[model samples]
Target: MSFGDLLHQAGGMGRFQFIHVTLLAVPILMMASHNLLQNFTAATPEHHCQIHDRDNDTRRLNVTEQPGPTTELLRAFLPLDATQRPANCLRFTAAQWRFLNPNATGANATRADVEPCLDGWSYDRSEFASTIITQWDLVCDFRRFQQMAQSIYMAGVLLGGVVFGGLSDKYGRRAPLIWSYMQMAVAGSCAAFSPNFISYCIFRFLTGMALSGIILNGVCLTVEWIPTNVRTIIGTMNGYCYSVGQLILVGVAYAIRDWRWLQLAVSLPFFIFFLYSWWFAESARWQILTGKPGDAVQELRRVARINGKKEEVDKLTLEMLKCTMQREMASVKSTYSVIDLVRTPTIRRITCCISLVWFSTSFSYYGLAMDLQNFGVNIYLIQVIFGAVDIPAKFISVLVMSYFGRRVTQAGSLILGGLAILANIFVPLELQTLRTSMAVLGKGCLSASFNCTFLYTGELYPTVISKVSDDEQKEKILLQTTDIEKTKPTG
Candidate 1:
């Protein structure tokens, strides 16, 4: 490219701005689309128990009268031949609510004192855990099958992380991104139409496996694209974009109550992402060091152009080509190993503590969010509440990380979330207003911590965890447990 041409590329601002926004927006979009998985199983379909009679009769179960809570609870412990069924909540006495769980080792747990079972044919998200396991098929297989599906997906992510992360670094970010997105879109759509349990599990597994490639590297690609000055803000903001993904699930699920439609809704848009490379460049940092300085220079010229710098573009681009190649090559040659992450006393301590923090935070955050449906509120209302909190929590995160470093802010958020979860377990049902209030606070900070961890992990691992690092084993471990989300749903 000529000097003036370079200058023109940089000087002209109109189209370049759009390109920058478009390129950076993918990760945000990827993160945004993540909500479909996170919230799907938490959502349940409208169902009710069909009371039946003893064998030798083909008559459908009668619902001539609306049964009260007691009848509902004792309906489980009765003889089908009984002449009459009691409809009062008082009929079940204090014995049965505890029996729903049937394994609670606690004494004195009864309908009045225990959590109530939901009846009727509407969504009941609070029972997501129970519903998926025991409430499904009225035989407890619902929750069990739900657990298996999620577990398989998590397992796929583990494998994908190994396969994809290496491929991302080895082949450069663009190719795997192209391949995986296409696969995910197809697999996700197919999963919706799966006719059997095995088919659903297989397709969903492929969907997540495909996703691990894009979402994991998308963040790295963004980091490499932008300068360090505002990386935190950019990454966190991108993380908050996950709210958009969740919101998408909200709209889709609300509109299409069937799981099959929801599955189709979640997985169909990534085809455009498969074509993203036609308009975008690979990570310039990765390219320059990978002995593709000329290509990297071309990409940088585009970025500089987008940034609207008109002066000495070709000269600066050439200089980068010469100097950046060697520096980047040297850095790549020294690619990190896990040993470097913990070789020093300080490094190891930081690594251990932070790893613990990441694990604990992930475990608690998902555990709580999945349990939100069990709180006896409207599932839609609960979702709206949780989602609404995420926005403010994101806002606070931008401010908090600005005031304090990532470490401090993350620690504080995790601590608060941990305490809140503990507090919620003991909060009385009568004081449910306060219980919900605590839930809001806990979930918000938990959401914030979840966001904060991504930013923190990216910063903490630096050369070690970034594609820059060569500690394949360490990365494998990290990715193996990466999602750390609901392995199995609990109602």
Candidate 2:
């Protein structure tokens, strides 16, 4: 019998399982928050060139409340777009500012020589008090650096996923998880105090590594403890925790207003996770598979005792676990590494298809998530709606996956998500509500696809290779998501 089957015989899907899933799920909220923290941390708020004469004066005015003299002067000093809004990148020289009249002809305005922002920039502080963009001046020429930071973080996640997935398979799930939690806590806390953008990127990368371990191993641990019948429910709930965190982030970002404090607020709480992780139970199956039947027996006994299954504990013993491991070992044809995922023809085909699915889901989901402010709506309200839609999306996804199975659910959700995104192309810019609605719908569909892709990919692998190879493939594909998202805004 499989380890999941054995777990089923030992009082699976009970109070012990509930507590396990919940504990694993709690950290997911933190992962969710950290994954999208860039949305606020690197947000590019309204900014403009700081005219030299009014360096201090400009800082005091709201973006909408442009000073009368400065506004009139800017008409001469700044080039206008077709909409008549001042161009963001170009400003006339100081001499041009002095020579201009309020009633200067359009021809005279055209004669002014323009230059890039030379006196630095001022930002609108009404919505955000400060962000990484303002903190390090990551606008204009430095804008691509922020996008690079996001990609760097995602690359870090891929690195951690490979390392920790192997560690979990070799050393067992629980210990590496504790280490990941600590890694995230320390690295994230340090990031809040980053003095420069490069240091901040390094810290964020480390945090991403920790986040990958938490997400991969957390899901693995929870899946091993539950029975097959409720795996869908528990997995769906795991995805919901991320949405819960996203919802919480909308509130937290609104309250914190500053990137450093916001980073601190999100990072410090992870120390609590590190402390709580001390109580986490190791995976009983990992114990048995690695030739530590004694530890496996003890873990099973603990589960049985907590679940009130005394008779089941009586039935479980060291010798039985050893024999079961022996049978499992004998049945395996050969040991395989992550390389085998593409080494064989059949495995290679499956890997490529599933990797594509994973790539698309992650690319669309995060790309939309990171650009939440670009939709031209009330950002806070849209964030709430985007997050709120996940609740029903999960519910509907569970229903569809349960009835129609993984393949249909994956294809259907992706198609629907594409349709929703395409529908937005026709939404007139004037209809902000319609555009926001379509974007939210697309996000919800992609969110559902994201959850289903994990479930489907997990189901595709053999139990022996499931923990290591499968997760690595998914992470490898997910790593490309940041690279893909890097190109999205330009398109």
Candidate 3:
């Protein structure tokens, strides 16, 4: 019998596989947290140019706290926009400040040319105490740095997918998987104490690198162990875990207003996961393919014991395993590379089509995710809703993909998502409620598209190139698209 056939006879889709897949889901949850952590950690709060109160009189009169004489004085001289809100990045000069008085009766204040903030920017600490924007002053002319920091992190993910993908294919899945978890833990922890933006980006990049391994290896490990028939269910369940984690992040960020503490909070979980990494089982099939029949047999026996099938597994001798490994190895070739994916006409067409789907899905999904506040609602509440909507969408995608097939579910959802995105363009800005609803609906459809695309891609690719070639290409496309989006001015 083939290894898969043997595995089916041993005990496919049993308690052993279920528990193993569940353990693997922890990293998936953390991946979601790590991926979207930037939305809060780099968020820019309401801010205004710091007025230099030389006399130290206005320092205590924060307008957000309470209005006072000092507050009125600063408001009179500070440049106001068309909406009458204080200009965040510009202020009146000291010479102009002297002529303006809060208590003067009918005194005409001469308009002065606005200058860039000299002292610093004052942040509204009501929602957040410190973010990358507040910590490094990535506001005003420096605002691009915040988005660049995010792109830098995504670049790390791109590179990680390339490097770790090869390493996992070369080495067994377990070692690379453990190494990625540790790297993420160490790098993410260090990121919390980053003294400057440069160091933070460096650590975040490393964390992103490690994240690719977790994703690539974790999914591979779970899928390899489980029966092929149940791969879709498991994959969808993983997506659900990711979306649930996104919802939980809303509370985590809301409670921990400081960016450093939030970073620390998110990173610390990886340490626990790293320690639990010891229990992770190596892929028996990988061992058999790599010429380690002895280890493969031992792992299979262990799995059988865990699933309470020792009686049937014991009847299978060492010779049976050796023969099965030889047959598997004889049929398998080690001469594959990413170039071969496009070497054939059929594969090239498949690659191009899937790549486009991945690019568009990622662009719309993440763009909508990051633009949650643009829905004209509370940012935190909107983010929570966005995440909440994804849970049902993920489960539904699995059902639809299973019943309606991959292409139909994938194409239909993508079309719906695109339409939902265009819906926002025509909605009147004054109708905030309607616009927000459209955005939420669009996010839900895009979430479904995201889930379906991944499932479809998995079903489309041959097992040999799934983690290596396809994942790398998809992540690179996502990073490239997101980087371009970040360069555009925020609406």
What TM-score, over all chains together, does every model reach? 0.73, 0.87, 0.88
Name model 2 segments beyond 4 Å from true: 1-5, 54-73, 95-105, 324-326, 331-333, 426-430, 465-491
Error of 2 at 266 (Å): 0.8
Q: What TM-score, to 2 decimals, does candidate 2 have? A: 0.87
* Model 3 worst lDDT window (10 residues): 482-491
How many angstroms is residue 445 displaced in model 2 relative to the true structure, after the best TM-score fit?
1.5
Provide the lDDT at 126 for model 2: 78
Give a tens-digit lDDT track for model 1, residues 144-254.
566567678767766777678778767877777777778788987887676666887797788777767766566556555554445566666666666665665566656
Query: Model 1, poorest ten-residue lDDT window?
Result: 482-491
**Candidate models: Cα lDDT each:** 0.57, 0.76, 0.75
Clashes (N, CA, C under 3 Å) per candidate: 15, 0, 0
Tens-digit lDDT string for candidate 3 (1-491): 56776677568888789889988897677776788898889888888887655434443345424433345555544676656566788877643444345553323333566678888887887778889899989999999998898889888988888888788768978898899889999999999999999999999999988898888888778877887677767777888888889877898999998999999898888888888888888988778767777787788888888888878678555688777556556535555677856865666887899888878888888888876655667878988888899988777777887799878888888888888889889888899888877777777888888787765666555544322366455411111110001001000
